[model samples]
Target chain A: MNPPSGNAGAPLLEFDRVTVRFTDVVALEDVSFRIRPGETRILMGAAGSGKTVLLKTAMGLDRAASGRVVLMGEDITRRPETELFDLRSKVGMLFQESALFDSMTIAQNVAYPLLNQKAIKMEREKMEPAVRDSLRFVELEQTMERYPSELSGGMRRRVAIARAVVTKPPLLLYDSPTAGLDPITAHTIMALIIKERDVDNTTAVVVTYRYQDGNLVANFRYNPNSGRLDPVGSQGTNTIFMVLRDGRLAFEGAQAELEASSDPYIRKFVKRPERDAA
Target chain B: MLDVLKGPVQAVQGFFELTGRAIRNVIAKPLYLNDIFLQMDSIGVGSIPIVLLTGTFTGGIMALQLGRELQQYGQTDQTGTAVSIILVRELGPVLTAVMMAGRNSSGIASELGSMKVTEQIDAMRALGTDPVKKLVTPRMLATNIMLPCLTVIDDFIGMVGGWVIGMIVYNLQSLRYWTTTWQALGWSDVVQGLLKPFVFSFVISLVGCYFGLNTTGGTQGVGRSTTQAVVVAAVSIFVIDLFLGKIFVSGQRGL
Candidate 1:
């Protein structure tokens, strides 16, 4: 498939039959997919179905036991950790738990990627403003001095988002960004994600259990002029929906194809009450 | 049958791997000097009160018990010598490490375990910072540097406790007590005392970090790692102390 940018260059991420194992347990098995630049891929699965593992494998945080993973045109399947740092700096990831350093304040957390990423070389004076700008992007500029424990879960997730995007990488991965949030809060989180996608035009892979979240990503665009999410229609967006079951990809297709899938496992993810009729 | 041994074998292998990585990170670029100082402040300065209290009482107890034994041999004035020898050569290092194993080992385990379960360590790596270099190496270096300092303070305070007991309880002269305590410690005894805590520091930090980084499950897993870190570190201290003491003894005997 062509990327949203219509750049027929190399894909941003490609997995060729990737498998990951922990001891005797297979976390991800023979999972193959290609994520092009400016495309958002939404991955859905039940708990322990390797959604998180797949994201980690893509980032080179977890090693692939077999097959190959080419990220940003580099074959990272067998790349040593030291060599992967520069490549990883170009790809931002939000862990499932927010994972902000408990010891650091919100500003410090946001500045972490900028200061630590070897590929990023901002002047020291530019750091605070960049941190402030990032936090302001998340609408949490006032919470600079506050530790993560001081913030609510949604706010902490936003701070994590700020940290992830501070470097302004071309690729982003969000692991269960809206998990454990109330409906209103979940919508807010999803709106922020859509805003990140529209403003930067960066490729994203969102791991989520809620089909509603995926539906939003696939069906809406952030209208920068109106500062709101506008319906873009599924055809207007370059998004793919993937469903994993028991360490294997059960389904991978467009929203219409997913909605028309006959597989029970794939149907289970799309069976949300409010969106059932759609 | 081999399956039964796999768990322990893998654990030992993992521990060594982590130890090697941590050691290498000490000399690697991007040394986390700030983290090392922070750990020193926490692990070193935070340990003073317990070390002081334990040292003082241990010396007082030794004097009270060993003073009578010395009196029976017409060597009541020798209380300082005996206390100094035991405290400098054995008790001070082992006891300080045991106490630190109980305190810092559990502390490091719980802190790192919490980070692991919450995926903060993974986040650190994801952010282009190696967790072992940022987390484990600092603790290892700080513990290695500070355990010996704490041992020195413990030995000095223990001798002071012995002197107080000798003067007040045994009615011995202050000058005699000072002289005997001063003369009792040989170079080998000092070397043995300093070396043991140095070795125990590695056990304390590495075992705690090992269990912590490997923690799974959730909060329950953190608690389990904390308990296991303390237990393994404390046990390893005693076992290592026995071997070290045997080596020192064999050397003294020219065996």
Candidate 2:
């Protein structure tokens, strides 16, 4: 597979023959996937199709019972928790519920990873600027001092995105970024995600169910000026991977290929349910 | 025969698993130092007043009862000695352990248990942090260190209780009471009483944290673990006390 633009060199992370088992259930089976240095990879799956487990394995939260998780060319499947900490510092996660610490304000939540960072000795001095920058990235600069409970769901998600990206990690993992949001708010969040990747060249692995038809069609257009294939239009063109039921790779291609796909699963995923189906 | 063999086999397996986890945790990072310090503040510092109050009252009651019994036999002078021996050798450590099992052990178990059920432990792991180091180790170290210190404090307060009852209530001379107590209580008794706490602390903390870390089924599991921790710790302390007493008694006869 051709590497995405802005990811000119080698792949930054890859899961080779990864298999995650939870007792009798196999969450992910023989899953092989890769994300380059600065590409956004979408992982699409139904509720229990193991999207969350796949993300957990990459984050080193779940052990790949039999395979290898290669990050920066280092096989980190069985690394010690301490070593995994260093690896995790280079990646950020935005959980489905935002998972903002209820006890902390938005600013404190954003500064949490920085506080845990062993590299930052002068925590008090460095914390404010980091929090400000992160909040600014998600356009949530004003709500820094407010608690998570005080914020709306959309605002909380943005705060979570801010916290996740605060560390300025090269890789970002987002779980259901637009699951419970109005279309406008979801679009706003998607735009912010696109902006972050374009401006900072950060690699994003987004797991979401919302697949806009217009966005998919526009993503197929090749930009001759940049010499890159845009997946979800020029505004957000990154690699996409879809996982289906029964441990099947339902779709694996650019936005163009996915838009043109005739597979029933892919069609069902991309198309809006008709009035009869609804 | 089958039941008997099955019980022993299961017990052995549990012991090995517990031992393996502890060893793995110790070798993992030694990150429990700060956590242990914080836990010491919670378990030892917080429980001081209650343990002291209970220890003192129990000692006073024992002294009063013993004094009444000895007075009938015209052996009233031995009341202080008897009270002191009981308080120092057994009652002080055992009572304090039970008190802490109710107060500190239950709290630790429930708090950690709730955090486990809520996916906070999973979050910690996802962040590339060891939950054992961050949550369990400090608690274990804190309870182990603080329980002994609390036992010593309880012993002192208990002795004071006996003195107050003997001198004021029973009209016994303070000097005579002190002399009898000092003569009857040897360094061996103190050492044996103190020794039990160090072992009891380890047992209480290990059991409390183990139950907390393994808790599931949500709020109900947290509640269940808390109750179980107290019962287990209290029972284990008594068992350890009996064995320690036998060892001391045997050693003294040999000496």
Candidate 3:
């Protein structure tokens, strides 16, 4: 039910022995994981290691051949398309390529989810402000009128992130949010993701290849407010850092545990590259 | 010779694969009539103006050319009968199908092809929605229903075009042209013209969507598939028309 209490309680999102097979290829095989409410779970894997497939499965984009994708205690497998729209509305996804509609302006792109939902039709008038607020949230308010083709790679990703979070979904799924960006820009995007999780109490599942020290530090913050996310030194905020590899839980527990991990893969993952390697 | 045979073999294989996919899709999820109606609006209603203009001009040109030739025998009065018969029985359906193949079939192919190239079709599948039901079936049903309707429109327009040329250029009376055309042409001529387009519609849509769904590579692949779909559909229409014409005309002569 809650993240900071460790893996004792029910998780907000759980994959129970999920498998995805495409002809001769098994994209994911018997993959299982759990992320409790208010957790920032990191799915780190090498390229072609099924991180994207895992994220897609959780988002209900990729159906598992066998097993269940339980979201908030409900098995969403075989859910009707109409109900899937509602499920999708509750989870926001940022694709690696941004995948913004080229025909739409930044504001229109951000407001897409709102317009797509019939339930939000009466609230259409509020879409503009929501778009503006989401853009402002990502620090891209001035680029609202620009098309996707007009934006830089970083700007486009931010716009995509803005669009994904515009509906203020409880779960935010990000596929390589900082991929193909410079180090500084990648850190900035990661910081924004951290800020969103803190401010909105949004549980985030980010699939990425980069493992930076600052990102690790950001993942280990402790705040005391509601055990979801509070400012550092706040009364009730607790953070747990996790890493998944080869479609399984590779490393979990406190930041100190990860730092002290003598496992070769964990050591290599946590090791800061020497100046020569850099 | 072997290399040339390769293309046909590949095409046949692709056709079989597409048919299998279509059958599986239909079994998985069936398309509704409302979708067919919307597609009819796209393939038929939306295409009417172009089909009319092209059919009329083709009819007029045929009449003008044939009129000049027939005047040598002072068989000019028979021009109305000849033009009406040809237009209603053969030219109308064939020409309309060819034009629709260029317009509606190619457009559908290109649009769907581009979506495939861009992974939008894959995106729909990932969302557990059948692209054939959502995209292809409606268009196919629409084309099947609308092609015959377009043929009827083409028949009406073609006759009017022949009448215009007969009255204005040849100094024939409009009333005489209509009476001669009506007396010479029968329900069978109209039925023959109408029948071919229904079959042609299926060929155009199936080939178009088939090529589109299987398109790969990038924008260039989409463009190539779109062009190939139109060419294949148009050629198949004429070939199919020739056979249908033989059957109908021979049956009538035997009668």
Candidate 4:
């Protein structure tokens, strides 16, 4: 059965009536959202509004109290953990903190997914080119042998992006991918995210609190043939923006719809400073 | 009061759950051999000097103290018997176990707690890596292999310390001291020494992993887990020692 919020065709992810609680607090309650194939859904919420939890829940990193998580035509809400590896291999998640294993080098971290899978486990030398290519994808090829601790905040996040997309997973879930970086770094990270979604046709679930970040990904289109991000007219309507507030989906629509929203909370959230507006 | 009972019960439940997962992951496919070897180096080879130092001082002191009693009765030759017997049957294993609980257990807890705080552990789960297999199992296996090895090394070093005392300080006959030391130790003593460390390894590593995985808050939580690991393992070592001692003693008597 198609869910209430599900888009046309089989959705890559569906959080049907999902609720998550931590003791007395409710992080997410009866939250349902569907991400269809080739669609980018930006999950944005204020700090502590549970955007990260929603992103993690979709990846099965966080448990839901009572809900059905249907993924790619299968109900996996109660799927056994052993079976989840196969589920996870199809989805790549970038954490808020990058979460690169500090014990490993950039190359080693990027190669982690390749090394974990049994069928794909090849010799170290054989894995090098793919690992290097992933690093190059994020424009950090020179930092391959360096540890995560050695890199700046932005560089580590880029490495994390490289690691996330190295396997070329069909679904990419990013939690604040560009949250803490400077403008250039944030833009670079967003460009890579767009490239992955647009060039590779990867379905994406991006979590961010900044409206500009959401607008940035929706504004640009990656022309695979041209190998560059070209400004799209009307942002192509392929990207769906969402605002989560108080454990529920408060807003869901296109960029224009979100910008035009009259809801007071959304107004305050979407309102830009005088410099940006001017 | 309800919360009090609930906390311990929940902790014990989580502890067993972690233990069961470690057991399953140990025999499962795609074993993390590199991690296991790395942990072996950290827990076993890295612990050599400390274990040897602890053993030597402990054995030397025991010799000095017992030498006084034996000298009073002109039974100085028998100091070797007493020292060897104590080191083999109790001091070597117990001492090494305590040291490991302090060193390896706290290290594991702090490392894992920090990871939990930083979301690296969750990151691993999201990336399709079971932290238990990639992280816990290797440490468990490493501790299991290394603790016994550490106990053996401790016992040997302790015996050397006793020998140094008997030959030089006490001015006892080398041949007599060596003979009594060997004669005082039976196969049972050796097995007993080795046995307790196996039990202690499981206690220390599992407790550390347990405290680590359950950590909350931030840096403070990591520190709590580290302290909790050491305290729990130290207390547990004694409790486990008591029970294992009872069983071994009765079994030896039966034999």
Best by lDDT: 1
Per-prediction CA RMSD (Å): 2.2, 5.4, 6.6, 2.5
lDDT of 4 by residue, A1-278 (tens): 12234457788898899999887899998888788888898888888889988888787777788988887777777777777877788888898899999999889899998888553555778789989888888899999889999999999999999988888888999989888888878877888898888767899999987777777677777777877777776537478888888888898888777778888887766845223310
Ranked by TM-score, the better of candidates 1 and 2 is 1
Candidate 2 CAPRI level:
acceptable
Question: lDDT tens string, model 4, B83-200?
Answer: 9999988888889999998898999999999999989998888777899998999999999999999998998888888888877778988889889999998888888888889989
Model 3 segments more than 4 A misplaced:
A1-9, A80-82, A118-122, A142-146, A213-217, A220-278, B1-57, B64-76, B116-255
Selected candidate, larger DockQ, 1 vs 2: 1
* Per-residue accuracy of model 3 over B1-255 as CA lDDT, tens digit each: 998798789887877666566545555534556667877898889989988898789778877988888889987777788888888888888888898999987988888887776555644443234567767777877887898988888877987888788777787778777878889988788778788888888788888998898787788999899999999888888889889989998989998
Off by over 4 Å in 2: A1-8, A100-108, A118-124, A139-157, A178-191, A209-236, A244-251, A254-278, B1-36, B64-72, B163-178
Q: Assess every candidate by TM-score.
A: 0.97, 0.80, 0.71, 0.95
What interface-residue Cα RMSD does candidate 3 give after superposition? 4.5
The residue ranges of model 1 lying beyond 4 angstroms of the native Cα positions read A1-7, A272-278
**Top TM-score hit:** 1
Higher-scoring candidate on TM-score, 3 or 4: 4
> Over the stretch B170-216, how does candidate 1's per-residue lDDT look in tens digits?
89899999899999888999999999999999999999999999999
| Ten residues in sequence with the least summed lDDT for candidate 4 chain B | B160-169
Which of the numbered candidates is closest to the native, going by highest DockQ? Answer: 1
Candidate 2: tens digits of C-alpha lDDT, residues A1-278: 32234446577789888889975788888887778776668777678888878787888888899879998677899987577777787888888777776767899888877877554433688789989988987778999889988999999999988878877888888888888899778766776676666667788788877676224322443333563334542565555655455554556666666657777777666754222210
**Candidate 2's residue-wise lDDT over B47-68, tens digit each?**
9999889989987888889999
Q: Per-residue lDDT for A41 in model 1?
A: 93
